[model samples]
Structures are given as C-alpha cells and as structure tokens.
Target: MEMTDLRLVVATGALAAVAAAGAVAVWRRRPRPGVPLRAGAVLLAELLLVTAVALVVNRAEGFYPTWAALAQDGTTAHRPPATPGRLDATIRRLAADPDLPIAVPWRPPSLAASPGGGATVAVPAGYLRHPSWRYPAVLVLSSPADGWTDARMLTAARQDAPTAVVVAVRAAPDLDPGVLATGMPLDLQRDLRVTGHRWGLVASDHVRRSARDVAGRDPGRFPAPVIAAGPGPSGLATGLRAVAGQLPAPLAAPAPVLAPSAAAHQVGRHRPPAHGPVSGIGLRHGP
Candidate 1:
C-alpha cells in the first residue's frame, strides 16, 4: 500500500487493538503470572501500539511521501547529478546573494513510460513567502546548439516576463510538441506551484522553423509563441499568426508577455568542453 493510504493507518490501529486485547487476556488468565510471560505479552502490545501511532503520524504528515525518498541515502548513490548542479557563477558577483532564483533540472518520469524532453525549472523569488500565490509560467524552447543555459532562460523570464515562472526546455528539434503540450506541463504543475492549465511559449527561430506547424496547431496549450529572432537582435517579435484571437493573461489580454530579451553578461568559469561549452544561449537582445 502507498504510505499515504488511509487504509494502512486503519489497519495498523486495528492490529494494535488486537494486540492489547491479547495482552489483557494473558495477564488475567492467571492471578500470579510469571515475570517472563507477563513481560513478553506487554512487550508485544507496546510494539504494536507504537507502530500504530507512527503510521498515524506518517499519514497525517508526509514525512516520507514515497518509499524511494525514505530509502534515498544522501550519499554517492551514483545517480546522475542534477544538471547544472551548481551555482550560476556570473562574473559580476562581489558578494553572495541568498535570494537568487532557484533552478532545478527536471526529467518528467512520465515520458519514458511517458516521453518528455528534459526541462529546467526556474522558481521565482518570493515563491516561499506566499503559499497561496500561483504564478503564470512560460517555456523557453531552444536546442543545445542555441547554447541556452538554464540560467539564461531564468534571467529572460525575470527581466521580460517578470510576472511568470519560466522553464528552459532542452528538447530535440523534431520532438512532438504534443509530448510537451499534454504531459510536460501537467508533470510540472504536479511538482511546482505554477498554474499549468495553459502556458506561454518562447521559441527560437530555429526551433519554430521545424515545429511551428505542430505547435501553432495547439493554441489551447501554446497560446502565444514569442519569437526569439537570433541572439543579436534587441527586440522580440510576437508570433500570433498561428495563435488565433488574443490569448489570456500572461499571454495577451490581462498582461501581454514581453518578448524575453537579455543583456550580454560574463561567466566567471564555465564548464570545460567535455561537459559542453557554458557560453552562448538565447537571443542576445541588447539592453
């Protein structure tokens, strides 16, 4: 049974009750019970009761939501480390800032059993301060060739689309947009606080060239496609030909999404070529 199941809690409680009844019977059977017999009965009852209480607590509070988490020894389990597992490491840093945005590379497990290209999640600042606040989110689609780092995608979202969460998608040029449109967003919503019903899309010209037909066909998922016209251009062009009518908030009506643009910045020390060049990604739109 899953750890959170109510049935498990009920079953454990019932077993504890049975154990207590058995202990009482053993104690009352003889006016003078031997120390060993009484002790053994009492111990069994205590064990069952303690186990029941633990189950109840675990049910109420998700200490170990899954068995995998409970068994996960925070050691060198030799699992693939989270991509870009370290700091953004910009050249402009004089002092460390604790309030920097959080980024976590996520592989939707549903993709193999469910197909999905890996994506990096960029959580905005103040996400923790307001538990009830849910932010709009966007997916910035670019290939490895574009050199779009997770950090760059996050920066674009913060500066241009300040009101929305952003996910830098590392996807193949030919991969089905359906894989992203249906499953990817759902998986993201399941894990993060962002609204997943619909998402705004940011596509590089290279990616749009190949997947535009498929992506444009699904306005329900990708309501607005903001084109990133190469790295040198300072402005972003809106792709509305495929997206019929004005889209919803974070896309068109409520707050039209500004094309994400970025200023050139320096990286202190990037990963070696063996790990892939850390430089070059996104439309290098001028300040």
Candidate 2:
C-alpha cells in the first residue's frame, strides 16, 4: 500500500481501538457500577473532541480537496495588464469552487522619498477606470514583508468588481514614533489603533505613529485612500483605540469613499516595484 494509505489506515485503526476500549470499559463497569464508567466516558469525550479538532485543523490547512486554499505569505504577482484578466479568471474559479467571492490584486503605486523627508507616491499603472483597465484600485499601508502574491490578492479582491486593483504601501521602521513624532499625531495614532488584528510579528504604535507623522506632513506625496494593517500586541492595542474612536482619516481616502469621477482616470502605465515595504518587516493588508 502507498505510504499515505498506510498512514490513514494506522490513524483509523488507532481511533477504532480507542473507541472500542471506551465501549468495553463502559460495558464492563455499568453492572459493577464504579468510577470506571466515568473514566470511560471521559475518555470517549476526549476522543470525540480530538477528532473534531483534527478535522477543523485539517480543513484550515487545505485538506478539503473541494474547498481548499492555502493562505499565502507574500508571493510574486503577475505583471500588470495581464494580471487583471488572469485575476478575473482565478476569482471566478474560486467563487464557483468555494461558493464564495474573491478579492483580486490591484496595481499598486510606486514609493519615493518625499520632499519633507517622508515619502513620495507615483502611480505606475494608469487610471484603473480608463477603458484600458476597468477595475478600481485600493491603497494599502502595511509592511513589505507581507508582499503580494497572485493567489492571495485574487482571493481577497472585492466580489462586485473582480478586477479592482490593490495597492499595498509599506512603511519604514525608522519612521516609528521614536524617530518621527515628538508627540503622537492623530494619523499616527490611528495606525497604532488597528495593530491588534495582525496574525504574526507586529510593530509598535510608536513606530507607526512616527512613520505616519512623517508621511502626513507631505500627504500629497503618498497615494490616496490608505488602509493600515498591523500585527502583534502593540497593534492590537492600536486596533482597540481605532475602534473606540475614529482617527483622522489618513492623507488619502480609501477607494470605497472615492467619487465616481475620482475613480475614473486616463489610461497610463506603471512601472513594477512601485512600492517597497520597510526593510525586514511583514505587515498585514487592510480590508
């Protein structure tokens, strides 16, 4: 038999053995009436719990062939123009297979140094709404370590418009509060507010505060509609702050809030690697 089949058989046998032992003990102790029956019941309950946990963990890890999707941590994305069409097909496929909508990747803007020692923004891809590219674009603020991958972006793209582009912006660590803000800026505080929702390593609100403080000084230098995603203890505290009270909107408006006219654009081409995350960091993407 194949190794995989053998493993499955062994696992099944083990479970059966456990169940059989529980049943035997339960049967034998019932007439004798003692703590043994209680012990057997406990064992049975443990087995059931383990089974349920195993099933769930397996499914989350993509064991379900019919609806499996591995969460990606930063994979290279397809080139622009071609990306939209491919994303459309992928989203459609995922939607049908998983019976759920998918979020596709968006062409992000390029990052440059701002005149005020912050950062500058350049849209490498032209107007997304232009006949050339019909999808809308979203601006993201996070870390470069959590880079884009074709599968991840397509899976997360908005459903109504599968072609929408996502622009994820990463901040520099040096821009943290210790570096940028003498006092916390509202925008910086906002970035700190939503850090709790992260899954992995997270940055401190002070860091985000500093970065945003600097970025905010030259708001025009960055893209419009910024969404921040952070991870870790500090990030969680920030998320609470953000939820407890609204922070001043970032320098840019989130794409959802843009007017139809604002969403429209003239056809243009963007260079690859338009934006790079801060060195040696991984950040979360925003909704």
Query: Distance from true position, residue 271, model 1, in Å?
Result: 44
Whole-model lDDT values for every prediction: 0.50, 0.30
Instruction: Show the lowest summed lDDT stretch of 10 residues, model 1.
Output: 259-268
lDDT, candidate 2, at 225:
21
Every model's TM-score: 0.45, 0.23
lDDT of 2 by residue, 1-287 (tens): 11112244356557756776676667676466567666767677577657655644432221221111122222522112211232343334434333333333322111223122332111112222122222222333344454433333333333212222333234565433212211111112121111101111112333455445434432322222222354432332333223222211111111221111221231122111224222111213332
TM-score of 2: 0.23
Q: Which 10 successive residues of model 2 have the least lDDT summed?
A: 192-201
